[model samples]
Target: MDMLLGVVVMLVKMAVVLGVALGLAAYMILLERKLLGRFQVRYGPNRVGYFGLLQPLADGLKMLLKEDIIPDGVDRRIFLVAPAVVAGTALAAFAVVPFGDGLTLFGHRVPQVVVDSNVGLLLVLALSSLAVYGLALGAWTSDNKYSLLGGIRGAAQMISYELALGLSLVPVVMHARSLSLSDIVAAQAGLPFALLEPVAFVIFIIGSLAETKRVPFDLPEAENELQAGFHTEYSGMRFALFFVGEYVNMVLLGAVTAIFFLGGWHGPFLPPIVWLALKVLAVPVFLIWTRASLPRLRYDQLMALGWKVLIPLALLNILVTGALLAAGV
Candidate 1:
């Protein structure tokens, strides 16, 4: 009976977390639209409902009701399953993200995270890297040349940037000396890694933007050449899943930046979660601002930047960090 009760409780908690995170991902799209509207001197999503608060819900409902179109001659099975894989992997990656130190619930002490693995940081990295597989499979299975091209570009881009991303973190791992995110946070209790590792932080930020496939690096979705890219043939809820997965990825990357560099849940005069949220949200806003301001890079330029510029910079950052740590300076 006790075991059954524990299982039920775990299931309930998992459901709530998944529900809330997915809902939040939906609204983040709406939030971006409304904010960008203000930036562009126009109102956004105001027509849907009450100051546009309900816009995401309406959009979600519309997608749900829309037809699930399977393009003729496509690999139907993978096409049907790819979006779920992407969205599910993205959400499942959040299980190790620590929301707070701990909380009191029904007089029981419980950790805010679903699973706090010893190698939580590595888990996050592995899951993110694996997401590219879903994209590759989806594009290939779609039987569209454009989608195939986008998928190839995306794979190459992610592969190139992920090296920089991983290298950029060597300093953090060196400083923290642990793969657990909690340990990383604890190491930064007084001083954030951003202060000590500014150059690597910048590299990481750039690499992260690439990893998330944001504008300026959104070569996969280059409309002129690839149409809608990997999901060009998808529509309605399936498309919505891909959309939500991308934004959720943004949130995840931002959270990682906060936790590893900016001092996760560390601040004055406010709760840890609040501080964490504020820091993490800043990354996505910066991304949106970049989208509104900067133009996308040419494919060759994108590849050149990753290979010629970011990779070397990230390696140098790692070396410098190693020197600093050795000098104990």
Candidate 2:
């Protein structure tokens, strides 16, 4: 009975998480369309569902009904698996994110997370980094020059930004003096790290946008230049997988940022889950705002900023944080 109960509970939680993530990713597409429309002084996605509420559903149906096209002479296996791998990695990264207070289920104290290792933060980082493999595979397997170029550019860009992204967390790890994400949150019980490590927070957010290949850093899929970039030849549900993965990744990054800098599940007046929702929503808005305000940097310029500006600043922030901690100041 206990074993059956555990299985049932796990399945339920998995269903809930995936359902919420899929729904959120779908709406995120609409949110971007609507918000970016306002920014550009236009109405967006108003043709489907009331106020475009059904736009995502329409889009999903379109993607599902569209023929799945596999490029001629392409590596069939890898091409088919690439998007799935990316989406899986993106979803898996959420395992350690505490959604809300622990819930009592079947007389067991079950936390919202699927797994809560001592190195939860490190695990999340590692999983996020691995998501790049999907992009690389999708591009390489397509056997097109443009796809190859986009894949190479995407891989190179992610590598450059990931270093800064990882380094920016050094200060948080240093201050919290621990790696477990829950401990990090506990350290910020009174005040958030964004207040202390402002520079690191800034670097992390910038690096995150780059990591996710958002606008102003979306050189990989610069449609005007790369013909839709890495997944250029992909169509139908395969292409939809890539699209879903992108928004899911955006949500994952936002969740990580919330836990690290903004204080995970920490707030007053509203419940913890509500606070998390508000924080996660802020990320895409910021991304869209950046897209509306800034121009994409040259590829070389983007790499240079990651290596020269963000990295050094991240390191310096760590140094200062360490010194202050040492001096008890």
User: For residue 194, what is the lDDT in candidate 1?
Assistant: 97
Candidate 2 on 159-248: residue-level lDDT in tens?
989899999999899889888887888888899999988999999999999988998899999898999999899999989999888999
Model number with the top lDDT = 2
Count of clashing residue pairs in every prediction: 0, 0
Q: What is the C-alpha lDDT of each candidate?
A: 0.87, 0.88
Kindly list the per-residue Cα lDDT of model 1 for residues 230-278, writing each as its tens digit: 8888888998888888988988887889998999998999988899989
User: What TM-score against the true fold does each predicted structure earn?
Assistant: 0.95, 0.96
| TM-score, structure 1 vs. true | 0.95
lDDT value for model 2: 0.88
Best by TM-score: 2
